[model samples]
Target: MAPNRREKGNTVSDSDPHFSGGGVAADGFDRFGTLPDCLLVSILSLLPIEDAVRTSVLSTRWRRLWTLAPLRLLDDSALRSEKFPNKKLLAFRAFHDEEQWRTQEGWRVRAIDGVLSAHAGPIRSCRLSRVYFHIPLLDGWIQTLSQKGVQDLAILIPMEKRFYLVHPSLIACQSLQSLELCYCRILKPTQPRPNLVNLRVLNLKRSLVTDAAINDLLSCCPALQSLALVHCAGLRRIHLRSPTLCIMMLDDYSWEVEELFVVDAPNLEHLMLGKNTTRRTHVKVLNAPKLELLGFLDMSIKMLQLGSTTCFEKSMVTLSTVVHSLKKLAIRVDFNDDLQADIVFDLLRCFPCLETLDVLIADMDDDDEPDVEYWKQQVSLDCLDHHLKSVTLKGFLGQRTDSGFVNFLIAKARVLKVMTLISVHAWKEGWVETVQQGLCLQNKASIDATVVFMKEKHEINQFQPWSSLF
Candidate 1:
């Protein structure tokens, strides 16, 4: 036996008789290792991410092959596995202790740095979640990623902890396309502000995004298409005037948002608001002719202005404010009184040609009774009479109040093709049959209409939370 030596992060045996002069015996068993560099790199790229990285241990030649493929790095998900109730309680306690959480996540951040040091471009994406770091380290990492041509990047800080300031290098990155930040804050760019010309998608959740920060960023993102702001604070007024933006979502209830006024958006299609039932922002649209999909419109908006028409406290449809261009509409309703139910009718009248209606029902007490006369006084609107084809009701509890609303919709939607009742809080065994018989779904106005039922306590709709639309 002879000694084995290490060289340049690789292992080699100088005393092995079977290996010599960069060539192995023709009849040897090392068939795959004999392949060319291009083929070897391609093969390594096909393997799973971890498997591909482990191949670097094979030989000196193989060590650098993993670096040639695209880089997708992650040091995320510190508590993703602790989803059980007992585990969640334990995690909830630890999560609130900032120091302990930071200490535990320190190793993952170190590993992220190690991988970046060892890997080569082009880095496709990098995701860092639940890992807090000192400002300097995170700034350095962002610079490194920009240099490596990172296209998609996400950094999610833990909730209830202090937020990090976004580094300027990230915005100045020439090759970056998508950026998602959570629990962070953005400073208004200084003199000679950098432009994110190539950026396309921007999603900010639970961040301290000031109006100045957002407006400045919006001006620089000439190519942005999708924008979502979820529960973000410090935005008093959001005014967008873009030619390329197509999808925009606003879920922030931060009292700062006084008004969302879109002055000009030539290509805008989806303008989704929040599902908040308590407060509403005055949304005034001056120009968005291409707007086709609008969702989760709360009944009590401060002032809904589409073009010149002012939507106010009235619960009646006015011809001037009709949004006939809207193809799909989603709304949030209280369903407690005729007043609240009339607001829905008014909304339907405003969108005479709506094809899809997705309604989110507010949670109500079981013992409470609803004013059924206001619902009885409800006449079929143009949408329900001729245009509406699909109806999706979320949070149906099969209560007496629920039966009235469901039956009203079932009877009036003459063209309704499908009605989905997502029962999130119904516990009774025969609740489904009860809702069916009580609502008289089989006698729905639309002769060929189909009914769909779902138990959705654990699974939400695909386009819910209003953030996913963008």
Candidate 2:
């Protein structure tokens, strides 16, 4: 027996018209079906196009609900299931395997296009990466979306390697708050006044666009809050000067980028640079007073300039310059040789006000310790004594070089509160004892410090809070 639920209009009994063996609602009846139409439509809008359309078969009440909801389509491409190191390589191979994937892709495109045509409500978001990016088809779809008022749009084709000039409809979509494009090209704006004033987030990865195009885009996007250019080609120099921007990530590892200069970004906060993938020789932050999080600074940077005066060149590694605005920093270093201790210590000295330090270690074949004297000769850094509170060492294997750096931190960082050691799953038997001996935790300088050892990547992502922005 079940209880009868009463509403202003009617009552819901156990005999509700739900198929047998279906999910039991909270009230043991069709309570979910009683939610207001607006909420139900909103829920439907978030689902994949296929799943959203399937809801119509439930009953007459849900038959037309999908048409009243926003349409959202994504690129659930088969190739994306496997994590390829390089996306450009996938694009090159797509041509050879075109016939094998054509049949499935053709069906997918037709279904998406039909759904777009059938939708009677607003178009909130669309990501057409898996489908063929024929210019005429894309323009037609975008024309419909512009009329339906799409807010977020991502037109990415991983199989496209050559540059195709983005249709003017993409830039003219006045309703867009976020725009992301990959494997396409954006030419210099020909319009007298391009209309992307409402866009708040823009990400262009693995695309081809000139500096003039970038400058024009930025000039038009007065409300953009976040911007990312990852592995983009044709950028020789970058000088950011934005008033509304807050977060900017520039990863120029795929090609040679000569310089990156942050001329003026008054409200800027997070800045993510390239790691080992970078050949960016010179980096300078002329004015970004609100900057807090900065990461993956290449250890081999040729020139680093901050504010007006102090310049630290790779020619003089012994000298240091401070960046007081940056609270969190990430550095990439490798220990192929027996000695990486000197450079690490010197680099840490440059950030006196750093509160959290993330050290990314590259895996090397050799694990033997030839000399540990280089670690002992280094003097204590200002960050180690007072400011540094947390340290995260990624790819920790407890090698002599790894241990030496951990030992240096444990012995020097007097105000340290937490130290997380992330193992890359390379530890052998008796690893606990080996780490204990290697780190010398018993002789820690900061009595309040606590150490945590994590082996999984899922746990590591929790600390990376801003990864979702890009």
Candidate 3:
């Protein structure tokens, strides 16, 4: 039998049998236990926290090794499982016994506390979701992790009316590089604002934060490069002026925001704005000179004013030279909307240097047909005549309107090299051959232009069908 468990203060001496070559048998065979400490710690880090802690019973040599491994504790499995009764016996019992629910909840809390208390090394990351934690206990855990030099932290709670304010220690931690918070309330700090000098990435989703609070946070993080805000309330206007910010994504599906203004991010490269279904918001891009990629999905905004223009009317759009630097553009169009077709043309004209265009067709009802004559009447744009090389049409339903639009692109784009048409629905008997034959008959401006037909199997953004070409 193994020797008695060693206390935390005990140190392994070099002369000890277990510390030396005891794992090697007399026959000269090395056992798995002979692996070095660093390799063993790595293996332990990959297992779940509970399983890793249970390994302490294997032998005296492995008793305290878990304390040295970087810990990652995520309490999301219980919430993610559909059959909750099978996950924990106590959970099943909780349905009948209120005391059992408290027991199970206490066990979960203790499990997290035990692992965090026993850890002797830096925690690489911690993501806690769907666990009900009191404000004091949550604050204590955040403070403890902050002091432990945690680099990445994510706290995601359920979308209940209850809002847990973030601990001050977490905001002021200098060791933190990435932070993501979901479904929580961010309280404004006291005067002489805190600075997260090392933070590079920040994501806030479904959180409540005032515009002033957001500006204050951004002002302190000089090194912030990427910021994403999804469905966050309490901000009617968002003004970003970061110098190092490269990517900004504002996905507001709730349509709570009324205005978004990108004031002066010079280094910004990619900007994605979710469709404003309410059609009440307006976006203005004042100064991102280096902006190359732009995506506007489900766009129904009243106005998308570019450059320093002050006009808010939808008909008064005037593109500046900054948008001409764009290399790629993605947009979604609803055929039912009369302005959508005109909006596409206006956008293409603005982005004269665009090399690739991705179009997602929305609302495929039979009554919502594209105006074929309107597409035919569109004068050739500079992008189609010179810069555009690739075009991807997702949700192509093989309608007369879709075919007319495809034919218009085929005949006008002189430098077009590849045109990908992904069917909106499943493949039928002669769909591929029919589309191919139709596209082949249309007048192609470039002899090298190739039309590729594919069935829609996955999301438009998840897989890039054009990656093989590059």
**Alpha-carbon TM-score of each model against the true structure:** 0.81, 0.77, 0.82
Q: What do the candidate models score in CA lDDT, each in turn? A: 0.73, 0.72, 0.71
User: Tens-digit lDDT track for model 1 on 1-470?
Assistant: 44575544556574443332234445542456456677866766555455677777655666778888876644344323223233564566455786655554565566567767877777788787753554457888888899999989998876756477778887788787999998998878885486789999999988998888888888999999999888788788889988899999887455568888888998999988776522467787888888889876766555677765665653433447777789888877777655567667777777888999888787664454667556566788888889889888887777666567778878898988888888754566877776777677666899978888878765444435453532
- Which candidate's TM-score is highest? 3
Question: Whose lDDT is greatest here?
Answer: 1
* Lowest lDDT block of 10, candidate 2: 77-86
Each candidate structure's count of clashing pairs: 0, 0, 0
lDDT of 3: 0.71
Return the TM-score for candidate 1, rounded to 2 decimals: 0.81
lDDT for model 1? 0.73
Which of candidates 2 and 3 reaches a greater TM-score?
3
Q: Model 3 misses residue 422 by how many Å? A: 3.4
